[model samples]
Structures are given as structure tokens and as C-alpha cells.
Target: MDRVKLITIPKIEDTRGNLAVIEKESIPFEIKRVYYLYDVPTGAYRGAHAHKEQSEFLIALSGSFEVVLDDGIETRRIMLNKPNIGLFIPTMMWRELDNFSSGSVCLVLASDTFDESDYIREYDKFKLFKST
Candidate 1:
């Protein structure tokens, strides 16, 4: 029941600023889709569900936020405030994104396309699924 983990990507530094790169080799899974969450209202929350099969890597492109992960038995909280770091969220784990600062941008690199059948949106049902 391993929860989410922070992944450090290759960061190239220069006088201009810094750049981080995430390739297929850097992540555990092959990325099939890329999406980002931004313009979140102050103190708002997102990602109140869990994926059944799809895995994802989350990065904070700007500003900061926190992710709450639950694996039916234990819960953990991870803060995302750096663009060079990302969070790898495996399947069958519940995740919630909250405590978003203003102008925060959360980028997500997914392992699969959008599939409604792969999502478990209810906490009770997710717990039941884990019991099996």
C-alpha cells in the first residue's frame, strides 16, 4: 500500500533561470496525455477521486498546493511548491488536491486517455474496491 511519491527530474540551471525535463524514462509509466489545472479559486480543492488503472505524474508549474493521498488504510499529505519536482500517483489510491495558492498551476502527465470507467469518484466505493 505504497502511497504517492515525489520524483525529482533533471534540472538544468543557468543564469536565466532553471529548466526541468521529464521524459518517458524519468517516469515509471508511458505518458499518453498531458493536462494542467490552473486558475483555481483561492482555498479551493480539486481531484476528489481515484483512478482504477491509470497512473499520473503531477507537477506544480507555478505557485503551490497540497495533495492528500489515501490508500484505504493510511493517509499522507504532500506539498507541491517546486516546478522541478513531481508526484507519481499510482492506480487504486485516492487523491485530493487542495490548499491551492493564487495563480497556482498544476500540470499532470497521464498514462492513459480519459476513461470514465477507470475512475472511482466515491470514497466508500473506493474503499470497497480495495477490499477485494
Candidate 2:
């Protein structure tokens, strides 16, 4: 729902270890910022907001987690458990991260810099904005 997709990044395998690579050409948008979430307590949640124009790609670097996506019309849950897999999130959708396993590291690649004005933090307000 809401055009969310699971993307596979290029992975290089070797005897030493495995490597995953991500570039602007491999993703749908140019990455402008990068951040991560880690050390979250069990049963806790994060990212309960929606962006007006920003988009993001989320990757599970160390452990597993679930992403809850809502578009004001439908909802879907996506699991991120591998370093080479990413979840691409488009604009105008609400996202929440939860069900994180211990030692989970959530890496996010964003298409824009941090802009407070672009965020819609309330669910009812987001629905109204989506209708208009």
C-alpha cells in the first residue's frame, strides 16, 4: 500500500565478510541525509509521523524490525531483517517503526534535509491534508 517497496541493494560476498552498497543511481531518489535509530527498548515505537515532500529508504543493519505504513486509505506492515534489503517510503504517508528485536540498528537514507515544516505529526490532521 501507498507505493512502499522492498529494495534489494547490491551485495558482495567474500570469505572475509559480506558487503552491501547503495548509491544514488540504485535508489529512486538522491540521498541528501542519513541517520539511524538504535538501542530502542523492547515494545517501544518510533517514527510516528508523515512528511509532505520527504522520502526515505530504511534498512536493518544489525537485527530485525517491522515498519507500519499508512496512507490514510490503507495500511501495510513490512519486515526489515537483512542488511541488503531496504524499504523505500514515498511522500505523504504516515510511518511507524516497531517490533524491533534487541540490538536492532535502523539505518535511514533520506531524500531531503531535516525540515520541521514538512512534518505532519497528527493522524487526524494528516487525514485532512490527504483529503485536500
lDDT of 2 by residue, 1-132 (tens): 647889999999999999899976778999999999999999999999999999999999989999999999999988999999999999999999999999999999999999999999999999999999
Per-residue lDDT of 42 in model 1: 82
> What's the CA RMSD for each of the models?
0.9, 0.8
Model number with the top lDDT: 2
Give the range where candidate 1 is weakest over 10 consecutive residues by summed lDDT.
1-10
Query: What TM-score do all the candidates reach, one by one?
Result: 0.97, 0.98
What is the clash count for each candidate, in the order shown?
A: 0, 0
Error of 2 at 66 (Å): 0.4
Off by over 4 Å in 1: 1-3
- lDDT per model vs. reference: 0.93, 0.94
Model 2, residue pairs in steric clash: none
In terms of TM-score, which candidate is strongest? 2
